[model samples]
Target: MAWSYRKRIKLIPGVHLNLSKSGISTSIGVRGASITVGKSGTFLNTSLPVLGLHNRQRLSGPEPPSDPTSSPSDRILPLNQSRGNIFSSDVQEITSQNMQGVKEVLLLAHQQRKELNSDLLKTKASLGGSKVKLVISYLLIYGLIKRSIPEQIKSDIESQKEAIAQLQQAVEDSYVAFEIDFDQELKERYQKLVDSFIQLTGCAKIWDVTGAHHQDRKTTRSSASRLVEKREVRFSLKSLPEVKLGFDALCFQNANGADLYIYPSFVIMYSSKTNFAVIGLDELSLSQSYVRFVERDAIPRDTKIIDKTWAKVNKNGSPDKRFKGNHQIPVVRYGELILNTTTGLNEQYQLSNYEFTEAFGNAFRDYQAAIRGTKQR
Candidate 1:
């Protein structure tokens, strides 16, 4: 079952603090209509109290029109766009799950972060105390106090604010990155793989094929169906092709299409869509195979031409003589790389280059094993 949380608390006249699972926002206006600003975006909300009707509309950052061609179908045209949440900005919102994992892998400057947070908390507490004292001193001015408490508190707050600013800059600069490293031979192989990835100038198809069954059918209405179907499995409520990959940190797309980045302690299944996930090298599984792709369009530079087949083919590999103006289409051999984990991380990518993709997959596994051996010692 799915669940959600939302609440509205009135802070003052015509002011409300709105809270929801997404984030916090404030609304300004009467019960009938108001403008709200939140982490997702700004919105205009209106309601009819007597009629028990309400309407909400986003008032900022209009979403881009959906691309009609992006939908999955039986058509031969491969999907051309990144298969995830459509955001106007390049930055992806980090989902709540696996956030701790992200913090552990990235944010290598832990000590600096700790110190900065401590100092900022102390300074803010002091500032808050000073403000309270200033308020009390003004109320009791005629009774006993002679020194200017307001001026003293003002000076203290200013100095503390300056100190807080300096600490923030130091925090930003003191951290060191824990980047992935490769040996000389592995590094060369990795670079070659990266080159192949960059050179994939054509659309890549990601296929998920389950078990196949043999079906026998007759032309009569009482006979069984002729077309057999295979189920496309969904992982975390997303298709296999929708998974993303990244190099900086191990990243995975959540059910809501948000990203969760983790430390790269194992295998990195990078997607061409700039999303990635990290799994332990030992637990990760990889498989590489050549796909005999029937190219209806221009062949990619990285793929190799295997053979030719007619657009209208018979039961065999030959062209059907009954069809007129039948043309031949090149059969290209493309590389398919499949990555899987016991935890349901299954991603498949069809790369244009077969040799390099296979080489990288094999070498990467060997490199992971070597690293595991060193760590065990």
Candidate 2:
């Protein structure tokens, strides 16, 4: 059996959303000339049917020129279309199938990253000899060798320009412009949510539920068994930096994978795997709870130690004296926050402070309601 998919949706004037088996991309321009950016890369397309002239070139070598009038659409490139890293797959929708591929890529890359990095460096070294002289001359002329402005600073400035140009081109090619105003109440609520999020400490993401078991017993039976669940959680290696959320936009670095950027209308989910998706704020939901976690490693300062448990516990919850290495462990209470949407956006985060997490969730919910009310009016 053979299957194929192709679609070209006109999002706005001179902007088209192209869907293909390869992945989703955006084309900006008119019939005679246009530029398309996608997972594959940027391509310039030009055609003159009357003159029978046509040309297509991939803009991979050099940074393309920018349009002064265009704005930046940082979240325009949907999932699997990012060129940052290996998560370059065509994510049509936020489905399990689409995300599974990304997870596989992440796992595979993690396993072979060392080998891949070594091989890549060796190959680059072998091929970089000819470019070394040019690099040195460029550095010298740029005052990097003189230790003046600093090469890093210069590179950063250039990079910022390139990034803006790319983002602006994407916006010009795909999005339409609109504006919304936030009332004083809405602003206050939004600020409260932001403050709560900033106060959160030491978060981890529950990536997968590895195993689950359920057992039921009749009332006649003295012994009863309950459901048991096991989850696979991923923690960030380093602490997140302090980032302020404004009325316009805010970005929260997820403990494990994606960075969640909240906007007035929607949220942008971006993963290190180079995948991104935009979701409406109305479609998103938040739930909060508390968990008594066994601490085998260093306990976070913000987490509350509500109880104690044995490393080797018996059926009755007592220490198993038979185990020579049995030790008492603190049972820390962690605040759990789960964000869900009908469109397969499910994420679980556990933080040290439950109060802050709960406050954020409540504030967000209230703010969402306020936005809905305003739109209706």
Candidate 3:
């Protein structure tokens, strides 16, 4: 749906806030590009640059016919002549004129957000103060393989951990990124995992999954060296492609989509809001699908069968025998990962409509940490 049109909470020009049931977010943009700023950061309506400079046209109503009868002062600005650009004097004039109004609207929205945040906090607390998010679910399974962490690998991770964190923060803002030394084989493997996730999720593009303010994104590595500590998999957005959606962010319905989709960290958030160290999976991970879990058992854990069978499909949504069964597929354990976030999701929710418990969470975490020369948190 065209949300901008549907959402009536217009603030200053090109600024809209949704305080409705859909969710809490400030959509700032006009037509061609918009960024929904929520508690989880921001999401884009178009894949523009960070500064939002682009030639792409926004969806607009047909232009009004020119009228010689109209006075010059009465005429509306032409679409192309509306403003110089995001940084031009024209845009400066517009912002100056609307600054007061913008501030007022934001102030009002912020108050409402505070109230709503309190309410949401109460609600989630009633259910559970802490939740074990099915962190690795949206990821592909093939990426979760790990072997013994070489001595060099351990030293590299410790030395570059700070750098890696900085790189993820930078990449999330837009296309900017940093190069880190890391294992090539690991990079190639992580790529497959992310690829599998996108294929199964039915998302239109990578931007839909993790773009900031709808800016462009990519996975890049410097052409520097190999067998080093920092690398693509370590620095890429895919590694930390997650936003914690706490009570503050869940006030809007739009925010729920990310809760269901998106690459996530398996970090446990306690009542104190302290996020446990994330357990990154390099091989097959265990996940519990709420929808599948619910549909299979209305009463919670009511599903009788221990090992249930389900149908399968190709990405096109058609039935295909190429899909393998649990018994048919070899259990690779730590040596290899069954990277299939998308495929398993298809089987549980779309095709078969059931959830498989990652009953292997603890063991898998130990294996993953050991292979990375780290301790499981």
lDDT of each: 0.41, 0.44, 0.24
Q: How many backbone clashes does candidate 2 have?
A: 0
TM-score ranking from best candidate downward: 2, 1, 3
Model 1 residue runs over 4 Å out of place are 1-150, 166-264, 267-278, 372-377
Tell me the TM-score of each prediction against the true structure. Answer: 0.43, 0.45, 0.19
Candidate 2: tens digits of C-alpha lDDT, residues 79-165: 222231112123225533222322332233333333334433543443354245436656678544554344444443343344334
Which sections of candidate 3 miss by over 4 Å? 1-180, 203-277, 280-284, 287-377
List candidate 2 segments past 4 Å from native.
1-91, 95-178, 201-248, 254-257, 271-275, 374-377
* lDDT of candidate 1 at residue 288, scale 0 to 100: 58
Q: RMSD, each candidate, Å?
A: 19.7, 17.8, 30.2
Cα lDDT for residue 331, model 2? 76
Q: Candidate 1 — worst ten consecutive residues by lDDT sum?
A: 1-10
lDDT digits (tens) for residues 116-171 of candidate 3: 44543443442231121112321433223432223333333333333333323333
Q: Output the worst ten-in-a-row residue range by lDDT, candidate 2.
A: 1-10
lDDT-best of 2 and 3: 2
